[model samples]
Structures are given as structure tokens and as C-alpha cells.
Target: MNTHKKQGFWHRFFFSLDHKDIGFQYMLTIFVMVAIGGFFAYVFRMHLAFPDMKVPLFGLVTNKDYNMLITNHGLIMMMWLALGMLLAVAGNFLIPIMIGTDDMAFPKLNKISYWFFLISVILMIASFFMPKGGLGGGWTLYPPLSTGDFGYNTPYKGFADRFFTANTFVLLAIVFEFTSLLMGGINFFVTTLNKRAKGMSLFKMPVVVWMINIASVLFMFSVGPLVAGTFMLLLDINVGTGFYDAYRGGDPLLWEHLFWFFGHPEVYVILLPPLGILAEIISNNSRKPLFGYKFIIKMTLLAGILSMMVWAHHQFVAGINPKAATVFSILTIIISLPFAGIILAYIATLWYGKIRFTLPMKWALGAITLFTLLGGFTGLHLGASVFDIYAHDTSFVVAHFHYTLFPTVIFGTYAAMYFWFNKFTGRHLNKTLGNIHFWLTFIFFNGFAFPLFLLGLAGQHRRIADYRQFEFLMQDPLPLYRHIATISAVILILTQFIFIFNFFWSLKKGKRVESNNPWDSNTLEWQTSSPPPHGNFETYPVVHHGPYEYNMPGKDKDFTPQNEA
Candidate 1:
């Protein structure tokens, strides 16, 4: 198999089609985007908190700059950080190994997806420097504002020559990014279904494999409408089409429907994989049989299905029909029930078992308890039509989103990284730095997000760039709360540098692994070398047990390897 072949630097990092190498590419890019997105958050938050003060690293945050900051922050984090890590990176890295395959079904296509993603990032960034400036029409990119002024900018006769405006570039980015994910999703689905080793049945698959598949499927199904919507909106900008312009005989609400239709399920597309990671870590660290393995799978499918049905809840206050809102409200609440079952199953998995406080598990515990709990409960408030009307654009909604999303996107990504550090680099990340990173992250994250919840309840609208300007919005504790959130954001963003250092430092100098499976994990990936050979395994494995097998009475060790006969 020519496993000893060496490649040049470009092929190794940038130009290669190897799934592992591609995963590395995705990982590096994801972190870079994180820095960019986090900095944007710091800038906008500073603008919100201290009205006219020029941010230190960044210069003065003009109204336009403020809009651009908040808009791009949401886009980068949600688009780049979340999907880049969970779907593109995780699918490429883990799907082949965990499913007992050497590589994806289409390796070159994997490379193409990443290039598409790279182009998308560049285009979005490029949008900021366009003649009309970036699309700060809010992250949702609603029309009228996004479509531009009512005059020559409306499309056709007024603007037939110029098609590549600010919004147009960003839309192009979205189109490219969607194309990339679609390709990756197809790769994941085909690879898992077609490439499993002999005797590795669907029921015996690792929870993560199922998760990536589900996330991919959800993304595939949901993103189509948004893709169409983006194109329509793009035509509205460049080609003089009025697909979303009211004056041009198009309805803006159509864009909203197309957006959230994908938007709500889009959350689960990034979310479900982390829950899968949590299950794996909890079972390994607690040394217990994962409770309700079958049930969790069933619940996950149910949740995915319900995810599609509840997108309308996002549009309840958008002037949709009351009956439609009521239907959405009902579906939104119903969706929570399946996740309840899943969370209970996790809690039960750890019930009275031997629990280890490893870094991955610590993050998992935080995700399961504090992060998910706060996020989930608050989510219920927004699901109801009545409360949503008030909280729709308040600081409370922002708090709810980060509470839910940051956990899955940020905490979940960290847990996976720490848990698999040995496998990725054949070395352990420094433990001291990991804990410090987690605790400081936990403390400051709460300090930042929790205050917003109080401010939301206090009627603090989220879109305001300056609270000091409005007499009604200038209550005593509200300003105090803004300061608290902003200060914590600075520390939270800085705390990540410690992790970045740990990652690179550990890569070169941390303790090298002598064992194949340091975690004593039951997954097939762990059964291979620390960093597996060119083609994952020396010999393809045949699985006998399910992914999580802990503390069986006859097992020599507490955890049973999946490949063991």
C-alpha cells in the first residue's frame, strides 16, 4: 500500500486528499476563524458597553463598523467555527477510523470540499472591503436593507453592470460554503454506509458515526432552501431581480421562512455530534455501560425530525399567521421532549458509577449539567409564542443562543480535542493548562452570558449600539451588567490563547504516547496506533461489541475494545 511514501509540505498540509491531512487542514482553519470571530465579539461588545470609547486593539467602532462587527461575528462563529469543526473536520477525521474504514469513499472530493470552504471564508472576508461595504443587514440578511436603497440599486435598469457588491460577495461565500458542506455530507454518508469492516453492523456503530451521519443528513435536507434563498437574494442585489424586495414585487418574509427553515435544524446539524462526544466521554470516564444506547439513537432521530418541524418558531414575531405561530409553538415544545429523554439517558449512564474527573469528562460534565441546562430551559421560554414576542430581540435571546450554542460549538469542540489529543498528535496536551483553560473558560463564560439574561429580562434590547444614548434604556444595573459581560468576554477570548499554546507546545514537546488506546476506549480508532498509520489500521478490524462496553464481568479490563473477539 506504499505506506512509507513521503510527500512535500504543500501536499502534506494544503494540497493533499488524505482524510487525516484534510482534517488537520480543517482544524487549523477552524481555530483561525475562532480567533477572528472572538475578536469581532470583543470589538462589538466593547462598543455596546462603553459607548464612544475606542477599543484598544481595534480602532473606533463606528455605527457601520458596529453592524459589520456583530454581523460577521455571528456568521463566522456559526458558519466557520461550528460547521468547520463539527461536520467538516469531525466527519473527515473520525468517520473513516470509527467506522473501520481506511478513508472516505471519495477522498479527492474531500479535498474539494475544504477548498470550497476556504474560498467561502476568503469571499466573506473580501465582502468587508467592497465598494458598498459589508452586509451588516444583521446576520439574517433581511431585505430592503440587505437589498439596498429603493432607487437604482433595486436591480435591472439601475444596476445591470455591477453584480458583485458587498452582500453579493457574502452570498457567494454562503453558496460556496454550502456546496462544500454538501460534498462533505455526501462523503460521510457514503463512507459510513459502504465502507464498514466485516461484521461491523449498523447497530454496533459508534454513537459518533451515527451522529455525524444524522448531522450531515439534517444539513443536507435543511440547507437547500437557504441556498435557493441566498441565490434569489443575490440576484436581488446583482442581477436586478426582486426575489426578496417588496417594491420589486417580492416578499422579504419569504427569505425569513427559507432562512429559519434551515436555521433551526442548522443548530442540530452542529449540535448532535457533541452530544455523541459527550456520551463517549461519559461512558469511558465513568466506566459504566452507556444507559439506553438504543434509546438515545431513537431519540436522536426523533429530535432531528422534530428539528425540521420547528423552524417556524423563529418567525413567530415576524408577522406570520397566528395559527401558523401556534402550530410552530406546539412543535417547538414537542422537540424538547426527545432531548429530555436523551439528557436523562446521559444522567442515568453516570448514575452511581465510577466517575473520573479527566479534562474531557470535566468539560462533558459542564456541557451536560450547567451549559445544556441553562441553554435548554431558556430555550423553552423562547419557544412559547407569548414570551418570544418580548424576548425575540432582547439581550435575553442573545444569552439563550450563546448559552446553547457556545456550549455545543465551543465546549463540545474542546472536549473532543482534549479527549483525542493523544490520537491526533501521539502526545498528551499539558494537563495543568487544560484545567486552567476549562475553569477560567467556565467562570468567564458564565460571567459574560449570564448577565445578558438578566439584562434581557430587564428589557434591554440586543441591537442597540449604545445604551447611554437612550434615556429609557439607561437604567443603573443594566449598564453595570453590560460592563460585566464585556469584561468577561475579553478574558474569555484571551483564555483561549492558553489552549492554542498548549496545542502547539504539546505537539512538539508533550509526553509521547506508548499505548495505542490511552483512554481504554472501546472504539475502533483507539484500537489502532496512537496516531494511526498511513491507512488507519495495519489490518481492517472486525467489531464484536458495540462502541461503548465498560465493566463487563468477564472482561480482563474494565473497558472492552470493539475489535476484540
Candidate 2:
């Protein structure tokens, strides 16, 4: 592995053990996946928006093709892009630096994890080219549909074998992705536990590190059942196992059980890290200490615990015992309290502080605001078992989760990117373009997502290729809503090119940062040079204060560095 200071591109990028290099690799990989996933969204949204109109590149999208696109879109965006960007990119880049370590505890494992992730991505993309499109059963891969007779009753007739092969590839790709994440999680735990700089105890670490650690632990434990479930699914598909086939004493709902168990916790696994990112940005940009630091940590932990208990909430209408549904509904509502507290804490941090409207700050604020609205939506509709039954398979669920995920994943990532672009690449991104990107994203994101709420409320079923098929959805005003969402989606997709161009063009030609601590924020990462070389610091840093100490009394400056002795 080449050192960070090495000149060769492949040596520095392709096969480097340095955590920063690997972090960049993850970011780049996610960028590509984002484009692919967005393309999938564009195609499918086109079908939804204008079902009869001929689509470019593939003509009209059949129901099977729509399923393939939607499944892969969800899979790619959530698992591959969001997880890779937040966990792999932010975790790898920030953890070592913020914790005052030179590198990850297992740098080799880190490198290997990324390579495996790349391989998984390759397999996932290749699966699309399979004889019968891609795995179209959906991202959840529900039992009977996922397992037996892939093309038996679907519109795409006479392609059972092809769909079967595609399903195998999807499962295999997910397996590899999970494997990579497991390796990375191990590295995160070990690094956080054993590798902090002197005086930097666990409590003194930044909230982001704390959140990532919690998320990692949550993922490690929760993902096991799903991994096993996938293998059983594979066997059922290929070797005639009856693990999920109800006809042969296997219950299809059993697959749902296992999937949602991992599935629900997996939401928090992706969520906690980005929530932490928002915490860091909110506190720093507000020029204040993070309010209720210890309390927030406790609340986050409670949320993690409750997240595991709420899996059955998703199964409320899936033939779950009514008593079980009630229990799960109660648990799901309980889980929201901690997050509510966290949100309140963020708001408290912003009260009566000198707020900076920097690029990252704008994105962070947008994320939190949107999240608050969506959080309300979740509480209103998803927390109640009765409401959930109505909204379960509707676009309401789609809008709700997209509200939750897009803000956290997409907006949170943009916050991190704008915040850290200078540190990562030694050049500041074009602020004008970034601001335009942020505004357009915020506008179009809401435009695209809010109508799904209306459609879902009107009982528009999710994952269907054409809304026109349903007479209720075909009624007046609903079609207009669909067209609105589709148009907004197109604008949303096109607006990203501004960010993409800015990212690359600025990488080479953006204004060079004058100082390492351009933000004048109180975090350890800023203590190092712009794009710190080789080992992160010339010497190990000793922590002298908590991660955020903005606007301390008797300080000459508003912010105080964590490393100041």
C-alpha cells in the first residue's frame, strides 16, 4: 500500500491502507452508485409520471422492468450508496482524526472491506444485465416471490430461469455488501475502543464517533439473522429447501419476521451516524456547545434498544397476531421519544447562538428541518398500528421513509461533504454552486416527496409499475399529483449535476484553502493540515477538552480547539 504522500494515482487510490484514501474511495464509489440509482429513479418515475409516453433508452417500462428498477433502486440507494457514503466514507475519514488516531486499528481489513464492497457493486450492476432484467421481487425479497417460480405469474412471461439467476446474483451481491460492512464495523469498534489519543476518553469523543460506535454494534448484532435468512432463501431457491415455502411447512411470514427484525434496526444503523453528523454541524455552526450531550447519548442508546423491538410494527397488517401488533405499536411509539429528545436538543443548541450560514450549515439546517417534518409524519402514521395498516403498502410508507432517508442520507452527506471537502481535497468547493445545489435539492426533494404523501393517503399502492392500472388512482387530481412528483423528480435528478460538476471541478481548481481550520471549529480533525499526509499528525494529539467547546467563557476566540492544553 502506498503512503498518503505518494504521487502515483493507482498506488494512492486503488490499493492504499490509509484510512483517508479508503474514505475517498468509498465516496467515489458511492458517487457512481448514486448516479446509477438516480437513473433508475428517473426511469421509473417517468413511467409513473407519464405511463403511456414512450421512455427513452428502453421504450415503455413494463411492470417487470419497473419492479427491477424499483428493487435495485432501493437496494442501491439504501444499502450501497447511503451505507457506503455515511459509514464507509464518514466513518473512515472522521473516526481516526476525531479520535486522534493515526489510522484505523486494522487498516488492512479496511482496505479489503472496500475491495469486497466494490466487488459486490460490480455483481449488483452485472445482475441487471442478466437474461431477465434484475431481481424484481423487490428489495425486501419477501419469501415465496423471492424464492420459487420467479417468472411464473408476472407480466414478463417465460423467463423463470433467467429471473432465478438474477435473484441469485442479488442475494450474492447483498451478502458481499454485508460482509464488507461487518469487516468495517469490526474496525470501527476496535479503533474507537483502543485507539483514542491520550486524555480522550470515550465520553470526551465527538458525538459522531459515539453514534458510529452505537450504529456499528447495532448493525453487527441485527444483521446476523438476515444474513442467515438470505442463505436459507438461497437454498430454497436453488436446492429445494422449505425454509420459507409455506406449502412445505415453511412459513412465508417467517422470512418477513427475520427480514424486519434486521430491517427495522438497519434503519437506525444508517440513521445514527448521519444524526451524529448533524449534531456536529449544528453545534459547531451555531457557535455553541452541544446541548444535553450526556442526555442525548442516553436517548440515542434507548432509541437503539427500542429500534430492535419495533420490527413487528412493519408486520402489523402482514397477518401478525393482533396482540403482537399492539405490543409492537407501543414499542414503535416509545422509540420516537428518544429521537424527539435528540431533535429538541439540537434546537436548544441553536437557541440564542451566533449561527453561521456556511454551506455545510445550510445543508445541516435543511436536513434537520426536513427531518423534523418527516419525523412528525412517521409519528402520526407509522407509530399507530391502525394507521399503519392503511398506509402499510401505500406510497405513504414510501414518502415517509424517503422523507426519513433522503434528508438524513442525501442531505446529511452533502453537509459532510461541504464541511469536509476542504480537509479532504485541500480546496474549498465553489460556495455559489454549493448553495444553488442546496436550495434546488431542498426545493425539489420536498416537491418530489410531499406528493407521495398525498398519493399514499389516497391509497396508491407502492411498487406498482403503473398508477393508471388502479381506477381509484386514475381519478382526477391524483394523476396530476403523480405528474407533479415525476416532474419534481426529473428536476431533482438534473439539479444533482450541479453538485457533481462542482465536486470534480473544485477538486482540481476550487479555491485552495488558506488555513487548515477554515471553519474555526473545535474538532480534532481541523487541528491537522488540509489533507493530512501519511500518518495523520506529526505527533499524537492529546485531548484537553470535549469535542465541542464553542463560545467558552474567558476565551479570546469564540471556539476553542479540543486539543488545546
Clashes within 3 Å, all models in order: 2, 0
Clashing pairs in 2: none
Cα-based RMSD of the predictions, in order? Answer: 1.5, 2.6
User: Which 10 consecutive residues of model 1 have the lowest summed lDDT?
Assistant: 149-158
Clash-forming residue pairs, model 1 = 155-240, 156-240
lDDT of 1 by residue, 1-565 (tens): 4274787888798888778899999888888788888889999998888888889998898988888888889988888889889999888888999988788999989999999999998898888887777668788888766665433343254453355567777888999999999999999999998999888999898888899899999999999999999988877666667777566577889999899989999999988999988888998999998899999999999999999999889887789999989999998999999899998999999998899999999999988876557999999889999999989989999999999998887888899999998997799999999999999999999999999999999888888676565675687877898899999999999999999999999999999997988888899999988787778888899889888889999867898888899
On a 0 to 100 scale, what is the lDDT of residue 219 in model 1?
Answer: 96
- List candidate 1 stretches off by more than 4 Å: 149-161
**lDDT, candidate 2, 1-565, per-residue tens:** 2144555898878988889999988888888899999999999998888886778866888888898889889999989987788788889999999998899999999999999999999888888887756778888899777753542223333345533477888888889999999999999999999999999988899999999889999999899999999988876766666787666677889889899999999989888998999999999999999999999999999999888888988788888799988888888888888988999999999999899998999999998888877845575568799999888889999889888999898999999999989987899999999989999999999999999999999999896776665788888899889888999999999999999999999999999999999999888899988888777887778999998899999999998898999
C-alpha-based local distance difference test score of model 1: 0.87
Error of 2 at 524 (Å): 0.8
